[model samples]
Target chain A: MATITRVGDPADPRVDDYRDLTTADRRPDRPGGRGLVIAEGVVVVRRLIESPYPVRSLLGVPRRLDELTDDLAALPVPAFSTSAETMAEVVGFHLNRGVLAVADRAAPPDVTALLRDARLVAVLEGVGDHENLGALFRNAAALGVDAVLLGPRCSDPLYRRSVRVSMGHVLRVPFAELPGPWPASMALLRAAGLRVAALTPAAGALPLASAGLAGERVALLLGAEGPGLTDEALDAADVRVRIPMAAGVDSLNVATAAAVAFYGLGCA
Target chain B: MATITRVGDPADPRVDDYRDLTTADRRPDRPGGRGLVIAEGVVVVRRLIESPYPVRSLLGVPRRLDELTDDLAALPVPAFSTSAETMAEVVGFHLNRGVLAVADRAAPPDVTALLRDARLVAVLEGVGDHENLGALFRNAAALGVDAVLLGPRCSDPLYRRSVRVSMGHVLRVPFAELPGPWPASMALLRAAGLRVAALTPAAGALPLASAGLAGERVALLLGAEGPGLTDEALDAADVRVRIPMAAGVDSLNVATAAAVAFYGLGCA
Candidate 1:
């Protein structure tokens, strides 16, 4: 059973893991950073509890803690109950979510392993926008993608905003940085016997549904919003596929496109 | 040919239409409101110039103005060029896009007239969130949705953020409020010979793709992100469809779900 403790002071040493959260969460994955996985609100906190990461503790007001009592009863972690003001002062921001949980960052999964056993894996390059990154994970989780493979220049998906925006799916979805060359890193998916399809809006590109991806093991390569996949990345792909859009239209938001593609691939 | 005027002062009365954009755009369609449609950036401004709405004026920096010279050359409207700093001061925030355009709200196309010819349309209810409402329009446009019909409690699509998020497609795609009794108002679409398909995550929903929506003229009913379609609205729909998300997952974001359904309807 988890230990429940009452903490009145905002500056208590025991709750340091929850201190100055806004600043600390900025570069949790950077050098000299703790890289803690933080989950906010009851739903996300519940997700963090169930994830593979090791949870250190939790801080929240009584009402939130009371709501989570059943979940806490099953966890072995400590739960600190405090006032909202104290929680706000401790975290340097009024966390409207009422509760926060922090867990240690787990190691990246094996790329070949994830690809070999996966039906649909999203391969991303230069998708640096945190919100889009988070939304993509949420879609990936909802659409039943087996894994997400990170390409070059992608943001750390564990960033707090991404974590929150993803509704904590960033922690649930297995992701690993594609640890090799730029465009050539794509060969890893091919070697694992998965077709690599780059999503583009070019006129000559084959329509997504007809790209022969339905029921195939596919690693769909996605890029940042405006400057989509680089030329080299496009050429490296086994084929280029487009979501047929109306004429004279700008592209759909990256995450939205990924959701449609995921639905098309996953459900087909 | 459009008249080109150079304004050096931030407080020029000629550019008053562009002042206090953050607040001015809060209620662009309400009582005593300016009822002006504003588009930001060159891309959107260009779209505004091309939309059915009557262009009131254009305020932009020299570079953006220069980029639009070809389009401007064909118009009789005034294009006011100003410094970025001056434009920023007038706009109540940093004008990073360096351009803005304002136009009168065009009279919406007759609801019956729009439905008469539309192969596909989106009917929204309680979609008060501006960004979602805007993203829905963008999705509708990308999927070649014929028009949008607002049922009730929907936000103004011409709001500045909506216009921006819709990538100015809000100006292109026609949307009209569905008047008359709440669910009964749906008969207008039925009168237009379009079948109304409501989307929900309820267990009884038919998976979108297998529902035979493709190759059919249909109207899709959508709702706010959290609450989804009202019971009355659901009852009014001819059929209920779902995206078939994984078990125990919350429903997809309203706009994302709409996109999947729209594509599933084979609008492309």
Candidate 2:
């Protein structure tokens, strides 16, 4: 069971991990940065506790903490109970959801092992927006995509905004950076008996319904909303598919497009 | 051609329609409200010019107005050219998009006429969030949904936030409020030769892929994220279909789920 500690002072060093969180988690890979995985609100904090990442501690108001009694029962970390005002002071902003949990980042899963038994995967390229990346993870989790592979220029799925936007599915979904040079690294998916299907908005691309991808073990390559998949990435894929669109419409948001492809490609 | 006039002062009465837009557009239906339709950014501004809504005038920085020269060539409204600082002062915030357009709200298309020739449609219930409402329109446009019917508790699609978040697709996709009492109003869709398919996460609901709705005229019923379609709404539908989801995960965002259903039901 977790230990409960009352923290009245916002400056206490024991609660330092929860201080100035907006900037603290921005670039954890840089010097003097702590790469802590943060989960905000009661629901996400519960997910952080249930995730593979090692939970360090928790901070919340009394009422918010009471709501998580069952989730904290088996958690061995220290739970800091504080006033909403003090909690807001420590976090550098007021959080409407009240409860929060922080964890240490875990090593990503091996790509080869992750793909060996996977049926459906999402490989993202240049998805630099944290919210889009996070929303994609949430969609991936809901749609039953077996795993996610981060290609070149993709945002860190573990980033704070990404974690919150994904509703903590970033913790539930296993993701790893696709190592090696750009499009060349995608060969790993081909070797694992998965077809590499790139999603694009090009007029000549096969419509998703007619692409014959349903029920196939496929890796869907998606790109950012505006630029779309680079020519090299599209060329490397076994097939290029598009969602049939109305004339004069630009395209769907990247995450929304992924959900459509995930459903169309038989992820469910 | 638009009449370009130099406006050096922030308090110019000619630009009253574009003043303090954030609050002015909030409750346009209330007393003392102008009830204007606002479009932000060059892309959305161009859409406003092309839409049925009568463009009243435009407020923009020189650079952004210059970018819209071709769009403004046929427009007869006043174009107020101002510095970025003056534009920000009038709008009550920093206007990063550098352009704004206001138009008179046109009468909504008749619901019967909108449904008559529509092949695929989306009917929304309790979707009060402007961003979600807007995003759903963007998805609807991209996925080829022919029309949208706003049910009870739906936010105004012409609301400024919805217009911007939809990338102005709200202007492109035809929509109207489903008039009459509650779920009973849905009978109009049935009379129009369309199936009323309510989208839910119920376990017993038929999977979207297996629902056999592809190429069939469907009016997909969607609700807000948390409390999905009311029981009364669910009971009124011809069928209840769901995007197959992984166990332990909550439902997809309402707009995202709609996109998945739109694609799965063969809007593409």
Candidate 3:
């Protein structure tokens, strides 16, 4: 069972981890940053409780804390209960979802360990946008992709926006930064017996479904939506697959396209 | 050719349509509404120029206006050039992409016309979120989806946020409200000889790929992420298809699911 404590003062030290949240948890790369993982709302908080990260504490309204009773019973942690007004004051904004959980970041897994048991994985290059990274993890989790390997120019998945946008799937999906060098590092997947397939909107690329990828151990490479796969990244793939889009239409959002490709490759 | 006009002051009467854009345009459906269709950024502005909606005028920085010179050449409307700072004052927000266009909405095409030409159409129920609706249109356009048919609890696609999020694809995608009673209104598509298939995650629903949807004319029925399609709507469909998601996960975003289904049914 977890300890439940009532906190009324907005400046209470017990809830220091939850204070002025907006400025306090700015990305570690930003100034005045602590980079703690903040999960909002009941669903994401539940996920945070279940995630591998060590829980520091929780702050929420009584009603939301009441809703997490079953989850709280399974974990040993301190949960601070307060009114919505105090939570808004301390968090520096009105969090409509009513509850929040903050956890320390865990060291990311190694690329080799991440791909060890994975049959399908996503290889991302230049996916620097936070929401796109979060959405990609959400898609990867839902579509049966076993792991995610981050390439150069990708944003930190633990960024608050990415964590929230991913619905905490970033906490569930194992991800690792590729170690060696750009494009060359991708050869590691090939050596592990996974075929490297790059997704591009290039006209000559074979249609995704017709690329002979169904049920194959595959790593699907994707670039950010606008400036697609860097030339070197495209050259590294064993095969290039296209989604066969309409003329004059721009490419689909990076995460949305990744979902389609993930579904096609995983279901195959 | 468009009449070139130089506007030196933010308070100029000619730019009234673009004034207080953030506040005035947001509640266009409320009591003091001006139901104007506004398009922002270069890409969307270009789409607005080509859409059936009548372009009233243009407000842009000289650089943005100059980039649209060819597009302006074919239009007889006023093209007002001003500094970014002046444009910001009128809009009450920093205008990135630096251009804005206002168009008057035209009567949507008849539903029968949509059904006659469309091989695949999307019918949305309770997709009240504008960004989801807009992103759906972008995907629909890319996947060669014919038209979008709105059912109920939807948002106005002409909203500024929707326009920007859809990358102006809303201007290109043809959508109209389905007439008659709620779910029963769907019968109109069947009456037009299109198969109405609902996408859901419930057991007993055929897996999308194996549902034998390819080469068949399909009108995909989608609902909001949480409530999804109502029992009435599900029962009305000729068949229910599921995307075969991993267990314990929520459904895919309605638009993303629609794209995968659209692709499965063969966009061409």
- Write the residue-wise lDDT of candidate 3 on B138-173 in tens digits: 998898888999998888877878888888888898
Question: Which consecutive 10 residues in model 3 chain A have the weakest lDDT in total?
Answer: A23-32
Model 2 alpha-carbon drift over 4 Å, by segment: none
Tens digits of per-residue lDDT for model 1, A102-181: 88888788887888888889999999999999999999998998899899999989888899999999988999999889
- lDDT string for model 3 (A48-144, tens) is 8889988888899999999999999977889999999999999899999999999998888878878877899999999999999999888888888
Go through the candidates in order and give each one's C-alpha lDDT.
Answer: 0.89, 0.92, 0.88
Fnat per candidate, as a fraction, reads: 0.72, 0.91, 0.65
TM-score versus the correct structure, for each prediction: 0.96, 0.98, 0.97
Best by DockQ: 2
* Worst lDDT 10-window in candidate 2 chain A: A26-35
Q: Just chain B of model 1: what TM-score?
A: 0.96
Clashing pairs in 1: none
Q: Which candidate number has the best lDDT? A: 2
